[model samples]
Target chain A: MPSTYSRTDLYAEVQQFYARQMQLLDGGAFEAYAETFTEDGEFRHTPGREPARTRAGISAELHEFHKRFDDDPVQRRHWFGMMNLEPQDDDTIRATVYALVVTTRPGGKPAIAPSCVVYDVLVWEDGELFNRSRRVEHDQLFGSAAAAS
Target chain B: MPSTYSRTDLYAEVQQFYARQMQLLDGGAFEAYAETFTEDGEFRHTPGREPARTRAGISAELHEFHKRFDDDPVQRRHWFGMMNLEPQDDDTIRATVYALVVTTRPGGKPAIAPSCVVYDVLVWEDGELFNRSRRVEHDQLFGSAAAAS
Candidate 1:
């Protein structure tokens, strides 16, 4: 950890990283989105559901997720807010944020989807922040009627 | 903002603060939980919902919330994970974490309740950390069928 990173520059950078990740995911850019994670990144959608533990696995899970909902008119949007980063002993940083996932159908107003808590362990490699692991504490919105994505 | 705070002590302190907050809230220690916040702390359960800005108001809100579910067999539990802290220019810090609120009914098994993002602004006052504000970005679980407690 650098001594000079105790200010707001690091905060701004972490915020931008989350904003970019949301944009890419919402824009249906899977490959580009996967690049944001480390080559050996991991993503746990829910506690019991399958976890994507590799870059390729994460990419495939997201691809299949979007594809499953392709025909549905509900447009999913992830809005992340209030990101805070804690520096680790090495170059790794852990970021935690509130995620508001909204869904809008063609004829209806936007409704709050299954929002979640985004826990990300990010690593600094090659002068860039890459996600080492992401765990989503999903809001099972409608209980049994809805499942984790 | 001290030169020595750049090390791991601050990080550990912030994490312990969060852990203590959770323990207080879950232990039914309302006074202690309310004391964790500043005198003028604020809590936003929803974007438009009324926020509790005063210490008394915060205590009342939480009291009412738990009271409503007192008779129910479901025991509400808040499991917080991956707390990250961002230091402000002043001495205030922003902490974000992934929160999983679960409930287990007497006859039913444990089920996940609505999980959301918990964004907390913490300030150090009088040699102790206090919560300045807490913003919960709910996924609007079950739409308007359920409200924040």
Candidate 2:
């Protein structure tokens, strides 16, 4: 918390940071989405499972993951909800969010995104908010779910 | 926070509460598991999709949901992780846990359980930790995921 920190304000700002990241990712602005995090920010989807740890890495991962989406038959969307914020230290707050990833195929209903929890850390830097770290806890056996795909 | 509440102690206690609940649920001890909640505990899988409220309701729902499992060939396990606690007020703390419900067949590898977030409101009542309410945020489409089964 900063000298001028407002609890409500900070929470709201942190919530919007998620919105910004979502928009950029959805709009195909992978680099912009990755910039939402700090230079040393981390995004881990499962404990001890972080594919990317920096903006460049995030961008590269996103590219490799989604660049093929256009060729695939299903469309995907990431929905994050149930956001709760807790102050962790002087400069950072942990934001725990529920993520719903939906995939839709032609002439079919939207499939619920897999179950996962995104534990994100947002920090204040020079009066701006940036995601410092994010760990996504995926509920999947090692190769159980992936083997299906 | 209580007058004598140690952050470390309370956190550990809360962590154990989750462990106990998991143990009971995994062991088919539905009634005992439901006892972990207060009289008016609420179990909502989605924000607006609460099918059961109150301890008795929770017990009833669990029985109805699980009674059929014993006759099936598959087995289930609930894995909870990334538990983050936040103080709600004087008497309650929110335990946000990432849950992965895995199922395995007799001769198959363990499958990824559906992905969901368990938002539990843990209350300190007369020195007992009771789950006041739990909202399970399941990221699945209405019937797309279930239709597969």
Candidate 3:
């Protein structure tokens, strides 16, 4: 590992990196976001579900997903809060947070969806940050059923 | 870091932790599940809302939330997907996920309430996990119109 940052610095780094990723997603920078991981990194979804186990696999999946969905005119803004961080030996970290994602369809008002709980396991290698594992714990779902009915 | 696990092992750990947390929530072990964080951990709600900045605060908030609404007899299962993780130096990590939470009302069957997105920042210390930050990005309120009406 390079130099270790203080808690405040570490938290700031984490927050900025996170914010940048979200910005990339909202700005349609899908490929840039995919490149953030290490060559052998993995991206897992739900705990029990199948995961993209390799960097290549994750990249390909992201590419495919963007190809299929990025063109939508709907606006998506990912909002996150309650960040928790801990130092694992000086190089790895385990963190969790709650998130609420808002997607506004064109010409429609925004809505408050249910909350989601997320867990992340991360490692720093070769001076760049890469995700070793990520688990998303979902919570309440807010608005869909009644609208459909 | 003690020893770097293979990508597969990391993914496995992520899955295991995710499953454990979910199982606890499903089994109504809310307090136990909340204990997953460090003493000074945080639980944040998104869309520019306030977050519980301490473990005790978050725990108390959840306890009250589940308790107050527990008698409502709503059985909820959170379905999570579209997860991504980022390494933020050593001892800290960041992640985001897409989620769909389904709430099954008593004898009403299961339905998708609303879809949401979450972002998490976590830390690992002493071989344990902790949350540093969380943000919720709510998409839409499903039953709000009817409730308002």
Best by DockQ: 1
Task: Name the candidate that leads on TM-score.
Answer: 1
Candidate 3 chain A lowest-lDDT run of ten: A139-148
Q: Between prediction 2 and prediction 3, which has the larger DockQ?
A: 3
Q: For model 2, what is the C-alpha lDDT against the true structure?
A: 0.71
Tell me the tens digit of each residue's lDDT in model 1 across A54-93.
Answer: 8788889998877778778677788765454667878788
Ranking by TM-score: 1, 2, 3
Off by over 4 Å in 3: A46-49, A66-71, A141-149, B1-66, B73-149
* DockQ ranking of the models: 1, 3, 2
Please provide, for model 1 over B44-148, each residue's C-alpha lDDT reduced to its tens digit, 9 standing for 90 to 100.
866668898788888888888788766654444566666777887777888787776655444344455677778989887866778899998765554664653
Q: How good is the docking of model 2, by CAPRI class? A: incorrect
Better TM-score candidate (1, 3): 1
Instruction: For model 2, name the residue pairs that clash.
Output: A1-A90, A44-A136, A45-A136, A101-A113, A115-B115, B45-B136, B101-B113
In model 1, which runs have C-alpha deviations exceeding 4 angstroms? A1-3, A82-84, A141-149, B1-33, B39-61, B71-149
Per-candidate local distance difference test: 0.71, 0.71, 0.61
- For model 2, the stretches where C-alpha displacement exceeds 4 angstroms are A1-149, B45-50, B142-149
- Judge candidate 3 at residue A34 and give its lDDT: 61
